[model samples]
Target chain A: MDKNLWRWIELNEYETPSVPTTMLAKRWWQKMLQTLRPSRVEVSTANSAEEEPKGVEFKFDEQPLLDSLNTLLDQQNQDDPRVTWLVLAPASPAWSVIRKWANQNGWQPVSMPQRDSLLTSSSVDELNIPSEPWVVDDLSHGFVRHPLGIRWLQNFLRKTLQTPQSPGLVICGSWLYYYLEKTHGGLNRQALTLRPFDTESMVTSRIAVSRAHAKRLVAVSEGHPGIAAAYRNAFAVAAEQTEIVLEMPQVPTAHGETSTFVIYALLLHGGLSTFLLGEVLNSIAPNLIEHSLNLLRSHGIVRYQDDQWSVTELGYPAAKQFLAQRDFNWTSC
Target chain B: MDTQKISDLFKTVDSNAALQVVTIILIAWLIVFLSQRLLPRLANLLHSKQRLYTLALIPLIRLVVVIVALVMLVPIFIEPTLKNMVAALGALGLAIGFAIKDYVSSLIAGVVAIHEMPYRPGDWVTIDGVYGEVTHIGLRTVELVTPDDTVVAMPHEKIWQHAVLNANNGGPSLMCVAEFFLTPESDGLVVKEALEQIALTSPYLQIHKPVVVTVNDEPWGTRYRLKAYPVDPRQQFKFITDLSLRGKQRLLDLKIEFAKVETAKVN
Candidate 1:
């Protein structure tokens, strides 16, 4: 029923929603006022989920996402041996819709190999390439930030682009896509992503939110549906209408460099286990890393779930704002 | 010139003009003080490019405010004539040149520094063998906060004789070099490749920039320089530390031996 709700486009074509000049001025004034007059530390509670709307609910429909995937497959030129479909999935919505679609369509899914095997593997045969179309669920998991850990990613990219292989789809996290675009530029040219939900789209959609609230949501979340949904849950619904709450967190405050980098690394990798996170930030002391993670966890900026620690969907908007303010490299979306 | 003509150079110094001068001074000082205090805070909140641009604006803003105050105040004190102005400046120069030649030179050099931009507020620079971040560019001296957090004030006149080595100039990309001296028995190619990886794998590295490893033959050992850039100039020290620590670890993992240098110990 939600078919064609979002159009799929090349990753390079995606854009963050533009903020209105008035809103930007208001935010700038707020920051200036805060600087001029110091205030008490803002505390955010993790139990805000209890404030969910009473009677109004919108369940996500998988039909549109599946149709978008079908369109991507149909658009691929089967005759061109050099072509490989690359998808950059956003960090929110823990599950992969593409993987589910692949399974439903009988397409095989490939999991990342162990980090050690990457260094020892010699050829493309190590991938055990299926004779049919395949989907690599999360390319972000293929490599570590360490020297020896990146070989698998290098080898996999070479196999996919250099040699003739089966038609395949590789899904990478948005942050990983940004990283790889800088590290490996050529693959960036062929990557695809789902279109962002701008103010117009949200207002026209089936969601019960008012137009004013939709604009604020788009402005804060930068058109990422998952992040928008996270913030949307904070809204109070009355007679099928969503009311905006002023208490929703605006931007997260990262106290120091350690906390900032921890948030950045988690976003870049989508999520990483505690051990892998430690390995990625080996320069930082173990105790400091644990402290920063705990601090961010309390702020709702990050959370540990499903064996991996990641920036929470609710905190993503604020975390992104924090990172952007500090001039950290970020995904375009 | 007659006494009447000499006195013509002076515009009437009424209470109104005095009040106007005070107002101008107060406003100008307020602007400069607030800008000096606030811009750095704002810059710290921003990312690389915006931060540098905001910081570099501080000196330029100060310069403009001072010049504007001078322009507004000069007319209140002197008659508007080429001859009067020249005669006034000549006498002032004579007294100032004799009394504070070094101070005046530093001031003029500060203006030139602003124009040449040898270093900006955020730039990491080494001047006259004193290395530090260019924290503030004052009228007579440039302030630097050294690596040890000591503030050093070097007169702007140093631009006349000393070489100003700017690491990042006014940009965020500062190249950090980690040097390694290995015994001649170690393989140069292997060390080179390993050093490259060490720099590449550094979390502090600016991935867009190229990571380079240069090898040289020294009498004591084979020297390797692994060079890369950090995302921010402020991260240069951390970047170098990470590179050095990890490079040594990786080299030792390869069983490479370090060249021992013997030097006399000083008390």
Candidate 2:
């Protein structure tokens, strides 16, 4: 595997390729053309329905990424024993790579307290940090966006950093990292983030990612691999089709403040179970929360899996821009 | 002066000139109306700083359109001679001084307000006793929509005698304080730390700004002030509510008691 395949850069250093001006102009023209000629769009949609595959799933094996991570880890460990490795991952796939790496290495994974347990003030003091060489697959899981929720995370962080303990690796969702950076001044340590995929890195044999497609993918995903893969899969009509028309996912109109808060909360915590979401946004009605979630899901802004609802990889770009437009604080993707 | 000489000071009244003057006024009104309607909508789509800047342009745009229309219309009504201009202005001044002095004063003050930018649209301002978000800045009056959703139109002349309190002049940052009066028996240090944490964890908090938890000894008890900035100035209420609610809950969980004060003191 190419050493640069999963290059680990600082969180601030991660750069998603900007969508080319030509691509944006092309997209704008296409939208205008579609608006002017709806009949043609209808015809193409009907034809594409039969021609396009049910889904073009682009599932990259996390093993390569883990292997790449291992190479970097060994080099970094050799370079400095005192350094703590913080892996900031995108919110969509949660902590799959970190979990896989921890499992393979037989490293101790920190247990996240139950949501109810986190509700008590004593829970923070009671948090037991794993001895040494422990792995926190996703730091976002350690806390919710509630008052009682963050105490545990704060306590856990203080213990992990201040105590005389062996260096450990912690994986945190980028969104959570950003939120913590705002609220708690963030972790002042060396962090490694996956390099965003650009046109040069995105080309493959199965489906040749055209320059335009790659640019669009990189722009939309902000170089997040999972989001990029989702985009590649969603836009691919056929394996043989050379020209992949990549359109940005449309963000659902956040008609009310509830929807806005729901999306912001989901992103801030890297996604939440409905119950936890209700706990964070306790003032909002449960049905209203459900309504917002359902509405968002219908627009493909969010997805439900493993009893959790997270911003979909494809929807992350639009959702992020949507929130940013409304002056919501966000972490750099 | 003879009637004919007085008549000579003015341009002959013509239907075309009257029509032209009306057309110019109508065009100016349309431009001002559209800007007042459209700019706020555009500003709403923008982020905080840009939103305020865009909103502030509403009054400036209206001022420009009115000035241009006046410049164009003045020539249609009065001759270009300095004597004619002085005579026309003297008559206009006398009418304004006696009939609508306050209204003219407010109009002049409105221009001054635009230049000074004491309070622009989107700014949380207090004039006289009314506190609300400045929604519009008209020629004579500044409109504000209070938290109760009541629209109050304050004359711009208030800027002269009354102090205009602007929470956020043109920036998004606005400090919000959530106060907790705890029993004297409660540990100030512990409550302070808890209040700080509560503000830090609040979703509405603007993390860029500092969160300060100040503890003061009061006659009744210990007053803990959790001060922080919200991501948007408009979220100040929600931010304070979140801080107070969580601060109270956390304090309660800490086994601390809130100070019970008299109803008069509370008021």
lDDT (10s digit) by residue, model 1, range A249-305: 433344457877888888877788898888888999989889878777766677788
Q: Which stretches of candidate 2 lie over 4 Å from their true place?
A: A25-56, A61-64, A76-85, A91-94, A125-132, A204-208, A238-243, B1-6, B41-47, B263-267
Q: Per-prediction interface RMSD?
A: 2.8, 5.4
lDDT tens digits by residue: candidate 2, A93-121: 42577677767777677777776678765
User: Candidate 1 has which clashing residue pairs, if any?
Assistant: none
Candidate 2 RMSD computed on C-alpha atoms after optimal superposition onto the true structure: 4.4
Q: What is the lDDT of residue B237 in candidate 1?
A: 88
Worst 10 residues of 1 chain A by lDDT: A116-125
Q: Which candidate leads the pack in DockQ?
A: 1
Error of 1 at A264 (Å): 1.2
Per-prediction TM-score, chain A only? Answer: 0.85, 0.82
TM-score of each predicted structure versus truth: 0.88, 0.89
